[model samples]
Target: MNRDPLPPLTAFPPVPFDAPGRTSPVAGAPTLSQLGDAARAMVPYLREQARNTELERRVSQKSTDMFREAGFFKLMQPARFGGYEYGFTAFIEIISELARGCASSAWGCSLGAIHQWAVSTFPEQAQQDVWGENPYAIMCGSYAPAGKAEKVDGGYTVQGEWHWASNVDNSEWALLGVVFPPNEDGTSPGAGFVLVPRKDWRIEDNWHVVGQAGTGSKTVAIDQPVFVPAHRRLTFAEASSNNPPGASVNTNPIYRIPFLSAVPVCLASPMLGNAQGAIEVFEELCGSRVTRGAVAGGGNRLSQFFPVQSRLAEAYASVDAARLLLYRDTTEVEKMAASHTIIDVPTRIRNRRDHAFSTRLCHQAVEGLFSSVGGAGLSLDQPLQRMWRDANMMARHISLNWDAVSSMVGQYHLGLEPKGQY
Candidate 1:
């Protein structure tokens, strides 16, 4: 099939970065450092837009356009589709930097970008269906098996309401999760995703929340059954096996990575940024902040207090530790993929363990920082309070939740069959 040519690489607007050695030879292709610098450059603008984003309950179209122009969304997309095909480590750095400005915006961007890689795991026809005409089209997803699919002649009839599809407002398609019924032999195909275009599904506005409100993680519904071709479906088994159908075409080591080995990083990276941002805000405030003696201390600088100093150190340590774990696991997996090595179960589970643990560390970092902020940090105008709320929300995700992942890890170590996704 003849597809329309993509826009010239030079058509992407250049993002201003003052740092030296940040340029890329390829017009639209961004080096990791350049991408990180671009994300850092957007911080002030994102912070300025933070409150309004929360109030509006969605990342502004302007912000989305800026991200697209910067080439962040193409980081993990297949090179065939004009993506940079960067690894998960690069994704971690860019997303964490964005989260330092606004967790919700970073999250919306994270999901949007990650789905590009996810979609690349489907059959070649499915990949073409999505990006053939519009290579820039992005997808939003709801991964729980909340939808039903009935097998038909050439495809399946799908219907359900998928909840918490982040960045749905800006997406052209959705990956809705569904489970296929067992075959005549009673062998089950298990849970998987079905690709549906925006025309087939409707977005429901119901994303009210105290944290990460700007993400606009709403519900996607198909009231009537929609026919989804078989090629558009990717089973959990195929994706986890690290040799999905798209691997034959994309051939990128990134696409060969097991789904659980790295995808959870998408959930953890935002919290990592939230905590780091909180630490920065707290340190800046402590430098000149003098305590008012409502009870005892009046003139002492907040930074002078032993407790405040300790808290700052603790927060920094926690965030640093989380980043290292995330980077270590992600990079290791990428290297394994590059070597065409089979990612063993132990390695995969260990990565999952780090994903949850790293998120917990980030959450703790923000919590400790928020604790010292006292009444001053409680104000709605303060970004610390928002970061605290956002970190809490990020940790609550099922994939990043400490209790769930820890239990799964424990089950494996104890020789019992692990029950959770890995």
Candidate 2:
């Protein structure tokens, strides 16, 4: 598995995409293709580390450093902070490639990287609060609106135990979801995110799980009330709208798109990679696997069996179909954002629908492959079994859950008000 070494962090220029007053590419920015190649080059090493990553129940710091050095975390960060400011489409490609080697590592990377973009949607001061001194800072988030925020003089007092803050171990800051109190008029409460530095909260090591264990998705607890400045808070209404506060400063069209329209792709991309990786493993195994049959007189090549062949074909097709849906929807959203087109409800729901459906396809592909592997895949040593478990866990995510997203899509089509997150 010899391959070229990863490109150095210096190889990525401060601004890959065009900035506000600039028309030319940065002097030394690496092309998107180079970034993709770098991700591919790390696959073998990531695959070798998969077992240990799972055993430790967290992505290794070495892997996290590798991602930073390769400039993956800067892909969606604001160019002002020495980031590439690349779009979600590039994110999907890179994450999927990484997932082919290790789903958990890929999941950690995916969330960490996407939060860079998420942070960019906050006010400029909040963005600076995060990347002011540390341009390389990355954040992990729990978007469940589980925390309570009390309005104060210049900020809000926030406290709660937020669950499933993925990649918390490797993150320097956290984007915690909080529910603001009712308005003066006694309107409904508003739900949103408040940025809190790692010092303000504590990580409870309770992320023991059967799948995606390497993600380090533990609980973030603020036992006592912590004051979060108003500038660091982003309301859901503002974030879901086309124009968020960050849009005023960043001015990149990428920052102007609705939050939900593209964020879920972060969740789907790793599952897409997991399915693709599983298929590759299945192909390799079928080539050398020989069935030990008692009644059928053993020693038959597994590839020769029609059922195995059919399952392989089906898995491949499912993965391909899933990839198509993901790319098509992501590309459309990115294009719309670039053109300054408002991402209307129909388009938003369509993207959400594709996100869940794509992961569902990936789950089906992994399940089919796992079912065909028989007793061999049950071993802890087998990557196929891990892929199966990881894919199942990803599909169960609320954002990518078929039942949850599909029902929202159905409600929109039926002219009833949709009831779930967009």
Candidate 3:
């Protein structure tokens, strides 16, 4: 059975349609956090292109350029490098804002921007190589265990096909995950993330999917065996313990955060954006639209119908609860990262729980919207249809699966000595 949480007691009132001081053209420029009405207004324009984006199977090159010119890619980048460095909470907030416009574009922006923060945690040499070419350089990622790495004299030889790399077409590089035999004894396989240049591999156009079609999440196959210097490979375990090589470069508190917490924020921010986008659709339909199989004046005001009202309240509450949880978790992550303290086990478990729950809430919220949507909502003009499909598709991503998260949390709570619970 689908269960929904009650709205937070201290929930902020919904954004007023006539909120004062809303600004526009959010660039010219600042981070997404500083966005005013100008930025908020652009969502409708982007939503209009949602169908086009879907048909093309990716965000348009023009849209990518628009994002770049608007400085959306640097949301999590370090300020010292002409980047935003707004931390996880602000990043989540901004991504959610963009997502209200176009979910795929929001996904791309969230993935690429969060990669900047992850890279900031790597060795300074690696960071230099990354931003050296262009301070605004964007990076897509594939952190799944799908590639192989060989221990060389200095660095490592990497070769494999990494799939589900979102926003690859607009990225300057990729951070691929690989496991290699230990150099000391070749005993245990070493797991880490390695940054690779676009020139090092070839992109395979194989990301055909039912949802998030515009993420352009293709695969990269490095047949030639690219050489990654030892500096580029960053192990999450070591990083969480303050053993990262880039510690000397960034020394900033933000770069020392735990991977389990920070990584999930990167993955979930887009969904947050997606939920906000769905809310926009819901508001429009619930206000101006009329329901079928209902009397006049009874359909336009959907609240008049008990069933419609129930679903509206249910979906809104789910979205509201999920947004609050996401904000709280991101705030905690930022605080811990600033202190350079490795998150304890309980905290990590809590984070995983929050992440899974966030996705579940958004998925259910979208489902509720679909249910409440009059038959007319099943059309291109209704962005809710797109958001609903996008939410269902992204919910399948392993990172957001509530079952897996519940399993991990359950083991921890049951004293079952779980492995990889975080």
Instruction: Please report, as a residue range, the 10-residue window in candidate 1 with the lowest summed lDDT.
Output: 11-20
Extract clashing residue pairs from model 1.
Answer: none
Q: What's every prediction's RMSD, in angstroms?
A: 9.6, 6.2, 6.3
The CA lDDT at 244 in model 3 is: 59
Runs in model 1 lying further than 4 Å from the true structure? 1-28
lDDT of 2 by residue, 1-422 (tens): 99999865331123233322122123355667788899999999999899999989898999999999999998888778888878877888889999999999999999999999999999999999999999999989999999889989998999889999999999999998889988779995489999999999999999999999999899999999989998998999999899999999887788888999989999999999999899889988888888886836268877888888898888878877887777777777767777888998899999999999999988998998888878878999889999999998999999999999999999999999999998
Off by over 4 Å in 2: 1-27, 185-189
Residue-pair clashes per candidate, as listed? 0, 0, 7
Residue-level lDDT tens digits of model 1 in 1-422:
99999865331122232211122223568678788899999998998899999999998899999999999999888878898888788888889899999999999999999999999999999999999999999999999999879999888999989999999999999998999878769999899999999999998999999999999999999999999998999999999997989999987778899899999888899888888888888988898678886656678778887888898888878888888888878878877888889999999999999999999998988888888867888888999999988888889999999999999999999999999999
Clashing pairs in 2: none
What TM-score do all the candidates reach, one by one? 0.93, 0.93, 0.88
**CA lDDT of each candidate?**
0.88, 0.88, 0.75
Q: What is the lDDT, from 0 to 100, of the residue 130 in candidate 3?
A: 92
Task: Provide the lDDT at 87 for model 2.
Answer: 80
- State the weakest 10-residue window (summed lDDT) of model 3: 17-26
Over 1-422, each residue of candidate 3 has an lDDT whose tens digit, in order, gives 98799765543354322211122222343633444343466577778888888878877888887777676676567665677555666666667777878889878878887888888888778888999768988888998768778878789999989999998888889999898666676466467789998889888999888889989999978887889998888875665664456656765555666777757776676787777677667767777775566556554566566777787677778878887787776666666655656667788788889988989998987888788766767887667888888998888888888887788889999998855637
